[model samples]
Structures are given as C-alpha cells and as structure tokens.
Target: MRLFRPSRRAASLSVVLAATLLATAACSGDDAAGGSGDDVVEVNFGYIPDFNGTSLLAVAQDQGLWEKHGVEVEATSFTNGPLQIQALGTGDLDFGYIGPGAFWLPASGQAKIVAMNTLGQADRVVAQPGIDSIEDLEGKKVAIPEGTSGDMILTLALQDAGMTKDDVEIVPMEPAAIVAALSSGKVDGAGFWYPALATVKKQVPDLVELAENGDFEDTVAFPTAFVAGNDVVADDEEKVDRVLAALRDAIAYRADHMDETIELTAEFNDLPVADVRADAENVQVLDLEEIDGYTQDGTFDTWLSGMQDYFVQSGQLPEAVEPSEFYTGDLFLGAGE
Candidate 1:
C-alpha cells in the first residue's frame, strides 16, 4: 500500500498541517515506554493490514526475536505510507513497513528506509470478469486506495493499455472497502495487495486478474521496507541495529517454515489459512544484500520519479522536489552483514 493521499491538493495542505503539528509536538516529552527496564528500547512499528510487513511483524513477535535482540517492539497499523512517515517524523513511531510509494518520500529526503523487508510479490489488480481488459475500465468506477503504490501501479497499467486517469473514474477507498464496493456494484473494479486480493477474488469468483506488478516492470521485484525515522536511527543506533537483526532472523525463519509462517500470518490477520498461503506464495522475502541494492542502484529512484511525475501532472506536489533528499540507505544491512 501507499503512504500519502492521492489528491495532490489535499496532500499539499496536509504537509503544511503535519509540519506545523510536528514542530509543536517536538516540545513535548517522549511517551513512557510500554514495558519496564531502561535497557528496553521501545520501537513503534507501523503496518497496513494485509500487507507482507504485517506478517513479518507477527513472525518476529511470535518467535521472541525482538527479545533476543534486547528490543521491545510495539506494532501499529496505518492506513497508508505518507501517514506512516508523518508519524515517524513526529516520533510517534520509530519504524514501520512501507511500499515503494512511501519510499519515494524518503528517497526525496522526507524519511528513511532502515531495512528492506519484502520484495517481488506480484500484487494484483482484480476486476469483475466481464470487464476483461484495461480498456474495459474506461468510464467505469475503479476503486483504489488513493495515493498508494497500488494506485500508481494501476495508473501505469492503464497507461500501458493506452488509457489515462481521465479515461476512468477513480474512486478512492481503502483496500478492505474495495471488496464491498465491487460486490455491491458501487465499483466496476479495484486494485489491491495480497490477502485482500485473495479475499475479494474468492467472494467474486468471476473476478479477472488484469495485471500484476511484475508485468509492469518485469523484475518481479517491488520493495516493501522497514523504514525508521531519521531522529530515531540517529539517536538510538543500537536499537535500530537490534531491530534489523530481529527482522533478519524473522525472514530466515519464514524462509525455513513456510506452512507455519502462513498459518501464523493467517491467525494474526484473522484470514483463512488458504488465503494466507496463497498470499505467501506471491511474497519473496529479501536477504540483506538484495535489499541494499534496491536503495543503492536507484530502483527506488525510478519508482519515486514516476510517483513525483504522477503527482506533478496530477498537481499533488506544489513543485518537484529532489528525490535524493527523501531517501537514505546508510543504516541498513550492517546487522546481518
């Protein structure tokens, strides 16, 4: 999922409001740690429901990986990445999961990516079967989570099919909301990430899978990372290292126990085990080296450029901001190296 709102006009206004609030909140003291022991560093983690990062958190917590690393993590779910980054900047959260869209904000110097969590999942776009192809979406109400990676992906797919945003009516809604919207005939189609895609398709057996992330880029690689606030990483480097170590262990565990991971993820998400298994099949957990490359080689750079262009053309950003200012990769890969 994405982090920011889709309406450029709304986001611009929000950025101002968020910055003001952040400046004001900075004067207040930190909230009390969730558990005892000064040695215990509290890491507030943000997640969007049904994303791979949510499963990673469940895995890390269930295995006591954080405890082994001498850290205590408090997981929080967010509606999108921009809000996640906002919370990170304000110190409400220390770290969290964000898709490529959120990565743009940091790649442009708005935030930071501490760890690359999941990659290569073919997040799919499902439409009612009769809709058939992208061209069919024109004039139809397409439901998407506004300002997310999914929305951008959908937009790109439409462009590939010789269509543009102007060709279709875009309805902004959450991933969960898409299922009902589609079923009730409120929308002709929707773009969603895993578990929700599975759930929605199951409910609407006639759903058509119009496109996948891989089809757009052909790399089978899209990044969903563990991002930390700049202040949090700088102020508590040791804690950040410990968190990365725990996450690395969790990824290793997930690689070794597919069935167990799937079942646990399903339990944590309260979804059917089969659906979790299907979602897991699409997800490719990354090792540290691969994650590092994503940041270093400008994979994120290209994606951010696309987003910025989309925002600019759509009038989201007041003016183009340098993408480099938003991303920082210096802190990752050290723990598992």
Candidate 2:
C-alpha cells in the first residue's frame, strides 16, 4: 500500500505524463483499437471490477448487444481508473468506463467523455469494528485507491468530517489490496467502492461503513462515464455512437432482467451475487434528461469542477481545470435519439 501525501502528488499528473508520449502513439497509421474491422468495429473497452461502472457494459457484451449494433466488444478489466486512463492514453484502450479522475484526461486534452454512465452511491469508507465514524478515521491508517473515486470520496468525506490529510495516515492501494490490508489489520479503514467493499464486509462482518457519496452535501452518487481517447473519437465517430447506444441498450436490458444482470456481473467479477445485487441498488443508470443535464445544466460541470478544486487544493492537481473543455453531450444525445 502506497501512501499519498500532499507534498508528493499531482492529480492530473497521470494524464500529463502520458499525454505527450501517447497522444500520437495511436497515430502510427494503425487502426484504432475499436476501429473498423471487416465492417465490424473492434472495441477495447477498459473498466474496473466494480458494479457501477462495469455492470451495464458487461450486460451489453454478455447479451450480444455489441454484435447487434455491428460492434465487437473486447472488455479489459483494470484494477483502477488511473491504469485505465494510462491504457487509454497509450491507444491500447479505446474507451473506458471511468470515474471523475479520468475526466481530468479530457480536461488536459488527453481524452474525451463520450457519455455519462451511472450516478449513484457506489463508493464508501469501511472501517474496522473499532472505528465507528468518519471522525474515527483520524490518526488511523486509511487506504484508498489513489487517484480514483475512492480517493476523491475520501477527500470529501474528510472535509465533511472536519478533518484533513494530516489527520489520517493515507495508504494508497488497489481496491482488492485495500480490503486485504484492512482485513489483516494493516490499515484501520479504507475508502473504496463495491462490490469489493461487499467482499470486505463478508470477511469482517463487524466492519463499519463510515461514509459514502450520499453522506456528502449536494451529492447523490459518484459519477462515472464512458471515456474515449481523442484519436478514437476523431477517427471513428460512428463507433463511438454505436458503443454509447449499446450501453444504453444494456441499461435497458439490465432493468428488464435485473436478476440475470446481477448474476452476470457477479460471475464476471467473481463476486457474490448478493454483493453485486446490493451494490447495484446504489447505481443509477442515467436517463436522457439526466445525461443531457450533465452538460446542459452544469450537472457534469459542477461535479468535475469540484473534483478539480479538491485536486488542486490537495496538491493532486496543480491548478483548476475548465470542465467544459473535456466533456461533451453529443454522443449522449445521439444515443438517446
């Protein structure tokens, strides 16, 4: 577990470091990862194992929705959003179901957000039996997936609790490892998302959930989106739209077949079906108006702006980012149409 301190961090550094190296890495005249192949699009979509971000896409793939849309989807699992953003920048990944952190890539001219996905209570801070509340996290060793939704939510939760980085010993680790470290008593608490959190609770039935996205003011859930590299968006616009449409279709299918969808998500991630089902409840698939509202009414802007501010204030980002520059409602609108 790696700990992130304010003195040694840059929120947008992942995108910044890889931007120049990967911006044209895909421009070698090679077809994009999701480029047309024999009249079918080849999509290399990256995602984490959590239910919120990967569930619908997995539903799409499992139900053959991608093929129905004349696309072949290759789903790649990543441990965290930052790694997915890295692959996206390198052209190895065409699209990613990523969190607000990856949104920074687009703000820095590294990628594009095709459509908003879920806005739900997917993230939480789980503490050992000894810790009961956010205030209990103070002076404790806390683990979080650095540069991810877990990290962001933890930051906000700390602020809400009237705490700061100095209060807790931050341990940055992969989601799985966070659970491992916590279960083994290496850390007192961890900030992360489900269904991993579900696994932790099973292992430690006495674990306490300190906070989640809903616990914060003016927030319902953490935001996630279908993000694509600029090159993929530039060269194969139709593929992007088709992918978004497939996701929309997947969302509907999940609604119609809730049990089957949950089971599939559980199997895909090797998590308990009950865990998947429970976490699913916290995830809200965005509707047309909600998707459009993200950009039209400053919904997405507000979330991204707050994330940027937190990053800058925490030294994760050097300066503020203009949310409008990296996000768009075009694919979202087209999919709805």
Candidate 3:
C-alpha cells in the first residue's frame, strides 16, 4: 500500500515516487542519486500530488526546462506541507510546493519561502444546489482539509456570515473523500481547492459556489509557494538560483502556453483533460514581472504578513515569524533588492 495517498491533485508522479522515492530514506542534496552529467544539479523538489501544486513541475518535467537549466529535478509528492517540511528539515527534500501550510511551516520555523506559485485563487465554498449562501450552510456538514487555505477561508466566511465553526459540522476529510462526500450528499458543502474542487463540481454539475478566493481577498490571500529548507538558503545559493531559473522559465511558458500547460498537467498526472483544464482556469499563478512588482512594492509582504497575523488569531500558529526568518525573498529573480 502507498503510505501517502493522493489528496488534492493527480498522482502520476506520486504513484511512481511513493513506491520508488519514498522507499528511500532520504534524497537530500549531498546524497541524491547523481545525474548522468556532472554539471547537472540534482534537486529533490516536493509538491502536493495535484494540479495547482504540480502545474509548473509538470511544465518543467514535460518541457525539458530543468535539463535546459542544467538541473535534474527529482519531483516528489507529499500529502501536505508539513510532510514536505519534515523532509526538508531532515535533508530529504530541498524545496516544496505548499498551500495553507505555507504560512504555518515558515511561521513555525520549519521551512522558508522562496517563490509564489499561485495566489490563493482556487479555493471556495462549494455547495449542493439550493444551498445558495454561507448562512445556508449553518447546521449542515461541510468537508475541508484541515489547516488548508480553504479551511481559513471558511472560518472567516462563517464569521462574516454571522456563524461559527460550531454553527456547522466541519467534516475533516481528504480531498478525494471531500469530492465523494459532497457528491453523495454526505457533506452539504466543502471549503475546498482544485483540482479536487473542480473535480467534485464537474462530477455533480449542480454544485454551487458560495464563496471563493476573491471573497476572502479582503481578509487574506492564500498563496501557494515553492519553499526551501533552511540549510539550502544559508549555503547553496547557486543550486537555489538554478532551480529558480528553471521554475521561472516554466512560469513563463505556463503564462502563454496555458493550453499546453493544461494538457501536460492532465497527461502527467493521469487527470481528465477537461477537469484539469477547468481547474487550471480556476486558479492563478503569477508571472515573472508581476512577481517582481509584488516583491518591490511590498504588496507581496503585506499579503503574507496580514495572512500570518490572521493565522495567529485563528490559532493555527502560536506566533508569527519575522518575514526575514520565513521568507528569503532575495533568492529569486533579484527580489528584495
């Protein structure tokens, strides 16, 4: 049995890596299997086994961008951010793609942020038809992956709607289970993200979106990001930058080649092309120039810092870590200058 099963995204790489990579104790930088070529840097990059988390990775894997940048990416999938953070701390994973846990891992000093992957646009309060608003969800069952951005959004939505967690039965389930539950009427609704978010709605077309990433924008921004282990940031600048350069290229490719991005993601992850395309449309990733602006104008910092404070108030984090401690913004395409 695969110890870690697929949660939000497709499992093409996860299935292979679970049996192969997870079998290995660790694949840290110093101990990773050597590339056939000497100049190639080997990186153990971890991501959630889903479309939003794995899109750029899918692009890099399919488009030959990693090899073009002289890096050999060992793509690994985790069920969630903390698992990746555990691997990073133990020198197993060098970097990760993470969502809500992005805030906790960094704030708890378990990981460090390197770059933004998606700007928290994929999650929403999805419900069965006739349930048209957040208040309608009161006294009902709603499924959400615990500690995810979706969870945060729902918490705030409840407050805004004049309800509380107690007002609804919050059913904590895996992404796959959430899909099944919502479709079967086991859950009246879900605070969820793609591609599972897209999957459930497509499976049951009458599902209604009660609130979404944009609705929570006035409260917080749930960004998914590529995060690195502490040691890598402290010493391995070249390796860090090389990986970033390759990812940056993948981002550039994803912006204009969205069709290719959707197709490649579906192909690599064994997901339905239509649903994958829909999920792709549902989320948003920043381009290089936008990333630069976020970094320079302090919007990016504000986005995360405010969100972190809410995380503290929401009792997810005991306290906040200085942005400098959690975010190494100077590493990517010349940010933090």
Candidate 4:
C-alpha cells in the first residue's frame, strides 16, 4: 500500500481539520520539551505505526536518548503518510519518519527531508494465484496508491515486465484497504510497503510476492526518511540536529539490540515476532556513508525526477518539482555533534 501524498480531496479536508488541530495544540499545554532549561527543546515527533523507522524512534524513546540529547520527544503515531503530512502542515507535528511521500510532500511545499532513516527492501507487490510474475499481471486488476511510492513501484514493475499501465487495470486503494481488497478477491494483487506488506503475507498464505522495491533496477533503495516540518527546521535548526543525533544513537541501539528491537516492532505493530524479525533483516538502517551517497551522487535527484515524471504521466501530480530543492543532509551532517 502506498503512503501517499495528500490528494486534492485530502488537502481540502485538511483545511477544515487544521483548525481543530490548532485548538488542540493550544489546549495541550506548553509545546516546548518539558523543561525550563535553554538546552532543552520540545519536539513533537510523528511516525507510522509500523515496523519501519518508527522502530528506531521507539528505541530512542526506550533508551532515553532523546532526553539525553537534551530534546523531549512527544511521539505521535499515524497509520499512513498523507495523515502525517497533514499533521506537519497543520503545525501539529514537527518531525516525521515517512516514506517516499516525504520528498513529494515537501516538494509540494509541506516539509523537508533531513536524513535517511531506513533504506533497503521494504515496498512489495503480492500477487494471488495465476499471477505468478509481473508478466502475469496483464489484464488483471492491480491495486496501488496513486501519487505515492506504490505508484512508482508499479510503474517500475511494469517497466521490468516490458509492460505499461495500459497493460493492466489499475485500481487506486489506500494502504489499509489494499490487503482487505486482495483477501476478499476484489483485486488480483496489491503493492505496498511493510508492515502492511507483512500483514498481507501473514493473512493471505496463498499470495506470492511478485516484486519488491529493491527489485527495481534504477531505484533500488526503498527509503523511509526523517523529515522536519518546514517551520520547525527554520525556527530551531539545532533541535532538528538533536533529533537526528538521537535517531543515530537509536540506530546504533537497534544494531546492538536486534532481538529487543524486533520484539518492540512486533508488539507495536501487533505482528508475530518472527515476521518482524524477517522484515527487519531486509531493511538497512542508513549509515553516514550511504546517506551521504544519496546526496552527493545525484541518486536522489535521479529517482525523484523519475518519480515525478511517473506522477505527471499518470495524472496524479499536476507538475513536477525539482528534488534538489527539498532534500537535505545538513541535519544528518551535524547529527554526531
């Protein structure tokens, strides 16, 4: 399922809901991290409720690394990307661990990606019986979230298969609905990232994974990145640095405590520990070198440009945005400080 950018409809809806969020924020007491010291910074962190970079944030919270770094993290969990983007736009969330939508949303002028959180094999396509491969997908109904990573995955998959959107019937579905649709036989297959991908695999034993985001030739990394709201990064850049530092510590903690990290992911996502561990093995927490490569080697720009082209071609995005404008590695550069 796609962790998508906000559609026109969702954007319009956010305008009405944003007022409620503002009131809620106002009534929720001090927005600052719960301390009086100048060194202390309050950070409202957001993440998807799954086994992605959120697990790293869980490690940070569990290890008290955020506090140790002089930042108080008030963590909030959302189920998907668009909601997280909406929260960022409404000033309700300052930081997020998000999927490809992270860049696209920011390209739409909502937030800014500060660091690569986890980048590896995450997005997947599960096909039902008779759909043995991407080639078998022709004429079948395939579900994907438009204007998001899932859409890009499908496009790449089709390219790999020597097919195009016209070769299959594409159905737009949300991440939560994709599994249900597939299980109920409403769609022949679906594309999404985990823990939803893991969820569907657990629930639908017969479904076979046809492809993963890593399977793509050009775009091998399926990244869930750390992003700061535009205002948040502008107002207190140091806090952004602190948050990245805490996450770096958390990633190290995850490396040393794999079993515990898997357990936390399983419990938080309500999945079997085995599934969590299996999925975790496929995801690589981005290190400084790899993260730097994305910025310096023009890999991110190439991928983003390709993604924007697909979005525009598919009619999901009205126009393309340049990747270099919204992506950054500055916070990550200062993370060790």
Residue 244 of candidate 3: its Cα lDDT?
83
- Per-model CA lDDT versus the true structure: 0.71, 0.76, 0.78, 0.73
> How far off is model 1, as Cα RMSD?
17.7
* Residue 10 error, candidate 2, Å: 78
lDDT at residue 147 of model 2 (Cα atoms): 81
Which stretch of 10 consecutive residues in model 2 shows the poorest summed lDDT? Answer: 28-37
| Candidate 3 structure lDDT | 0.78
Candidate maximizing lDDT? 3
Off by over 4 Å in 2: 1-37, 219-221, 293-295, 335-337
- TM accuracy, model 4: 0.77
Give a tens-digit lDDT track for model 4, residues 1-337. 9887999999989987998898777544333432234567788888876667568877777777776777887878776666777888889998887776434676667788777667657777778877789998889999987655676677778877889889999998877789788777789987776656666766677787888866764644456777777888788777877788887777777777878988887776667888777777767765556656776788767766776675566565678887756676656666645
Cα lDDT for residue 50, model 2? Answer: 71
Candidate 1, overall lDDT?
0.71
Q: What's the lDDT for candidate 4?
A: 0.73
**Model 2 TM-score relative to the real fold:** 0.80
Question: TM-scores of the models, in the given order?
Answer: 0.77, 0.80, 0.81, 0.77
Q: Can you rank all candidates by lDDT, best first?
A: 3, 2, 4, 1
Q: Candidate 3, residues 23-78: lDDT per residue as tens digits?
A: 45543332332222567778999888666788899998888777666688788867
Q: Candidate 1: misplaced stretches above 4 Å?
A: 1-38, 219-221, 292-327
Which residues of candidate 3, in runs, are more than 4 Å off?
A: 1-36, 335-337
